[model samples]
Target: MAEAFKFELVSPERLLVSEEVAQVVVPGSEGQFTMLKGHAPFMTTMRPGVIEVTGQSGTVSRIFVRGGFADASPAGLTVLAEMAVPVQDLKAEQIAREIKNAEEDVADAGSDETKRVAQEKLDQLREVQAALGAPAAH
Candidate 1:
């Protein structure tokens, strides 16, 4: 039998997932990282990307997270994401629309600071869209 560890994914609105998984891959700010049973303890910031988990049943699932942090230890892994959704629930069209809107806002902003902020938001959206298998906006 494969070793399993507790995996919990949470968002502000609700707890999206909680279960024992054989392995989990998280999008760390430094880079992509994976966790398995009896892994070393560490903490790191998460980036906008897909979180993939493989369960003991040999089933694989994916979750889209905007940003967050992860805590890992010998016991398990806990991911506190600011926003997360099941990959199936993500709509590519909606994401594309958001990217367009953000781009327009960046262009229309009157001040440099505002434009910079909008551009940052647009970048985040693009990253999320990319993780969903959608082409990134130019």
Candidate 2:
């Protein structure tokens, strides 16, 4: 059997997952990474994407996470997510609306920094839309 490592996924609303998993794939800011038992210690800011967790029972769980912090160690992996939901529960239209709001934010920014941040958000939202099999944002 594969070694089990502690994995926790948290959102402001609730503790969504607390389990021992064989491995977990996380969406880091730089790119996606997989954590397994005895992974080296590290920390990173995550981006909006799917987190795939493979459990000891051989079941896989897919969760969507929207930006946050992730910590890894030999002992466990923890994710403090800004927002999280089961991937199967996400709505494509809802993500599209967020993309529209991000577009407005870019337009309404009062400074270059704000516009840059909004544009990054728009980019992430577009990725989510793509994951949902939705058409590209106009």
Candidate 3:
């Protein structure tokens, strides 16, 4: 069998992925980076984007993350995501609904800071939708 490195993906709900893979590409807040076996130890804040993985068996998977952080060490790569889902299962309609709700929250916000924070959340959601190639939410 081919040598593989451990990869773990964690979301608030549960451990989403735990496997031995050949490679992983994480969307760091600074930029996207790929990790292979024996990668240098490092850490980076994550952005709303895709996490690409190449399994030991050569199958590829794409997982979308809202945001969080990624760490790479001699043991392997670990991703702690705020929210994550397999790209194939993501639904545009659901994201569109979230955008609408966030808009409502912004309008109902009482304080200036609250309004700004709500708007920022809405913007991040929109960015994720766009990155997934979904049309702008109506």
Candidate 4:
């Protein structure tokens, strides 16, 4: 059996998840990475994407997280997300609206640095849209 470890997913609105899980896949800024019990400790910033949690009982739950940092330590893994929502609760229209907003942000950015940052966010949102199988945001 896979070792269980504490995993917590928190959003500004509420504590979304607090439980022991077999594994968790986080959408990091560099790329997605998985965490398991006794994994080496590290921290990373998150991109806008889905977090996959595998429970000890083999059940899987997915949550969408945008903007956050993940902390992995000897104790456990904790994700402090700016926004978090159950994947099942998300609507395609909602994602599409967000993608549109992101595109606008990219366009309205005043400076090169700001535009780069906004473009990154827009790209991340588009990736999430594709992952959710939503129609392309025009």
Model 1 worst lDDT window (10 residues): 129-138
Task: Write candidate 1's Cα lDDT for 38-105 as tens digits.
Answer: 98999999867789999999899998887799999887999999888888987877677778988999
Candidate lDDT scores, in order, read 0.86, 0.89, 0.88, 0.92
Task: Kindly report which residue pairs in candidate 1 clash with one another.
Answer: none
- Could you tally the backbone clashes for each prediction? 0, 0, 0, 0
Candidate 4, residues 3-84: lDDT per residue as tens digits?
9999999999888899999999999999999999998999999999999999999999999887799999988899999899
Q: After superposition, how far is residue 132 of candidate 2 from its true place, in Å?
A: 2.0
The alpha-carbon deviation from the true structure for residue 104 of candidate 1, after best TM-score superposition, in angstroms, is: 7.2
Give the Å shift of residue 47 in candidate 4: 0.3
Candidate ordering by lDDT (highest first)? 4, 2, 3, 1
Better of 3 and 4 by TM-score: 4
- Summed over model 4, clashes come to 0
Candidate 2: worst 10 consecutive residues by lDDT? Answer: 129-138
Our tally of clashes for model 1 stands at: 0
Candidate 3 minimal-lDDT segment of 10 residues: 93-102
Report clash pairs, candidate 2. Answer: none
